[model samples]
Target: MFLFEKAVTGSRKYWIWIVCLFAVIGAGFLAYLRQLQEGLGITGLSRDVTWGLYISQFTFLVGVAASAVMVVLPYYLHDFKAFAKVTILGEFLAISAVTMCALFIFVDMGQPTRVLNVLLHPTPNSMMFWDMLSLGGYLMLNAVIALTTLHAEQKGIAPPRWLKPIILLSIPWAISIHTVTAFLYAGLPGRSFWLTAIMAPRFLASAFASGPALLILLCMAIGRLTKSSGLREPVQKLAVIVTYAMILNVFFVLMELFTAFYSQIPEHMEHFHYLFAGLDGRTALVPWMWTSAILAVASLALLIPPGTRKNPKVLAAACGMVFLSLWIDKGLGLIVGGFVPSPLGAVTEYAPTLPEAAIALAIWAIGILMITVFYKIALAVRESLA
Candidate 1:
């Protein structure tokens, strides 16, 4: 709750990064203001493609936020000592990711003030309402758990026994956040591409892969900065988790392809076609999707083999590939693909304008800044303990 003492103190490079993040956030605010005044029309979103980059980011980050469970489950449930060191990092990452997810949702709303309506006029029947609830709850849950645990660690004492139940509750709460987000899309009747029971599972698999891959990179950087070898074991364990998750994620893609092509359902196959190839000569996203596939496969190549994965440089590259691949697959491809060939069979295309991209990038910068500050506080606490 009172962690700002450490957060306000950082190195020159850290301050520079924070300043850059602030600049980007400021620019994003300006862009958002333009959209706010002119309405969502300035965006690439059209009548058919209602959601764009903001929703896509929201969807992808929900997985990133949920991925925190990978670390939490092993540490708290199984009592894995290796993960005990970095569990705080994972929870803090979730806090930043969920914060971004909330911001994206807020930005996506044409009228930001209308967001309060979800709370004022609760709609239990709407998946969006459920998503809002889950995301909000998950954010609060992770913040409390992370803060309390860190506070206890700083005080050189165990977290209170009463906190254990709350910590345990976060395990399922994490899953629910992403599941509800998937349902927001999958439950839609006209959205054939998203209408699948496997959507949630696929979301989870990709989240597990991308989330831990990011954590691995962060752990490596933090280890170097802090001169702490404690992260080595946790990094290795997280790499294994990322490896299996990446494999499952790729398998899920295959399963989706098989379901679409094997059945030859026009509605289902159209989206895949639009994503991978061109639908009626509109192939804006074709190259991006293929590139994502290539990156994903290459990442697997580097990850599946233990020898390659053990090499830090190779592992870092592989982790980056996995993150980029999923970012494109889930963030760019999935959201945009679903809207192509809208329910009426019209092939309307959507691309983010400069203002839209700026706003999205701003949200990303904000998330990164939050992670930097939170991790700074966390590292300071660890240093004090040392």
Candidate 2:
């Protein structure tokens, strides 16, 4: 069936949502133009703290995109029937997210043409080279898997045998994308905040938690709107995945704290202090970090117990807390914590300027647009089949 059948068939509400996204995208494009003309100086970035909102978001979303494996693995490898319906949604989400990741990298480059440098030079020693390969490969894999499976389902036929190897390939491909992303930071010399052996595991843990938490919320919203989520069992199962992953994420963080404090390494300890208790009286991130802590604890309370997590309303709240908490900690705090206390012991802070925020918003709007259209198309096909 043609995508024109359902991708374009949306109610007034859907049309309004798409229009609003375009409005945001248009505004973002204007702000991006300003940044392009003025360069990185327009944003809060400085010589000391070079990376800011863009890199932070890129870091966080990498995990979200990688989380698709949580769904794909269970359904394909373990044959978990509960995840069958939600797997394609996860794939579509990966596609939208990786697209945003690439855009974030694009805008962060003062000269957009710099992307060609990476593409053309092909440095084997650079972590960035591998990161690009991982992300690019994963994006194509998910896109192919999702589109092929959906096409098959619309016609009520099994996906071709050739697709199985590709599906299996995506499971590890998803992991490589985030692992390489973590290495991008960890491999950097003198960045005490990101230098650690467990960085990849930390990234994976948070990705699994935040990604599935988002999927749960998306499935719930879709279910409410169409009255046919085809994801009730899958959503519940995903809550279980979120619970354990969140636990591991928290544990991994605690392990980092021990390594920093126990070893009494001032360089390492300073980053955590800067995040939670600010150094040199610059407390910009202190409040946000604390808020993330509070929300993390509250979410754990809501999710740890079977009784509370099983409640639809309660689960929704818990998932919201999980998503926001990780956003602040991983998306915003991690990047700042790493850059502050620059190599020479100068403590600099970073925040997004108006244009910077707009550009970020625009990227988010683009992702949402992709997801909205993809979901609409998927739902329409499934409904027709029913």
Candidate 3:
């Protein structure tokens, strides 16, 4: 009861942030309600561009949540003292991020209420069910593990000897959530572009890069605005990890393009054509496509220079660009682009309507708000313990 109460009564600033966050979310809620009343017709989704921004965000965030394991495995399993101070925060961030991912999907669905239909009447053959199961399981695992670890720390007791296995289990489970998410795209028999074996590896690489980039940016924000010492060494180490992951992400994308063009598969080439060339100027996603490329190159340039990576200002700029680049590349481009010139050879485009955008904005605001409130509680808890 004490712990529960403590969690609720956060600082005044925390409540202020919460109110602002909810104001944005409430606006989005009104927008989502409009969508629910009207139907998916309110958004830009047609038969061709079925999965739009919401689904794309769900995919990207799953990877972010999974990457929390990178911090956890090192600090907890391997006993890396460098990460000892910041790993708990990473765990909490993961929780908030995953919650947002779930909400985004809920809002995207045609029948938000019927979501239980997935469980009430399980589909043994559908990949969607497996995805729901994995995501739910992973969220529970992260929450339980993180809270138990924090509880142990507060009491100055070592984590339970047996909980180590659960932690170990979470590592692969983390990989599975994103893999299942990729499979959600890749498994569609008609979409030749996403049907490749390389999709899972590509997902892993991009997730690793984008996840750490966000963590680094978060650390920078903490250092600048607050009295926190910030995560210096661990942030640097994670940046190195991001660098390697970025290279792999670029390589996998190149390999995929090469394989498609080399194979001379007309079905495969069609998707790329829609993305790059634009089908009859009707499906012109050209601006987004080019912007993604430029951002990717710029991010790599900023990250590769040791001087730039270490400097707070430069690192923050690079991290921001990298984060946006991944959102455009994976969240918007990859998902929507794949469905263009869809199986029927008809070109369709997607642009979120005001309501859709509002709902999405609300969901994002809610996530930031949750992080702020939780962090306030965490800070107060730490000070009390000390």
Winner by lDDT: 1
Candidate 3 residue runs with Cα over 4 Å from true position: 1-14
List all candidate RMSDs to the true structure: 0.9, 1.0, 1.8
Between prediction 2 and prediction 3, which has the larger TM-score?
2
lDDT of 1 by residue, 117-224 (tens): 999999899999999889989999999999999999999999999899998999999999989999998888899999988999999999999999999999999888
Q: All candidates' lDDT scores?
A: 0.94, 0.93, 0.83
lDDT at position 330, candidate 2: 93
Model 3 lDDT at residue 102: 95
Candidate 2 segments whose C-alpha is farther than 4 A from its true place: none
Using all chains and alpha carbons, the TM-scores for the candidates as numbered come to 0.99, 0.99, 0.95
lDDT of 1: 0.94
Candidate no. 1 TM-score: 0.99
> Model 3 misses residue 16 by how many Å?
3.6
The true-versus-predicted C-alpha distance at residue 343 of model 2, in Å, is 1.1
Q: Per-residue CA lDDT of candidate 2, range 191-257, in tens?
A: 9999999999999999999999999999999989997856778999999999999999999999999
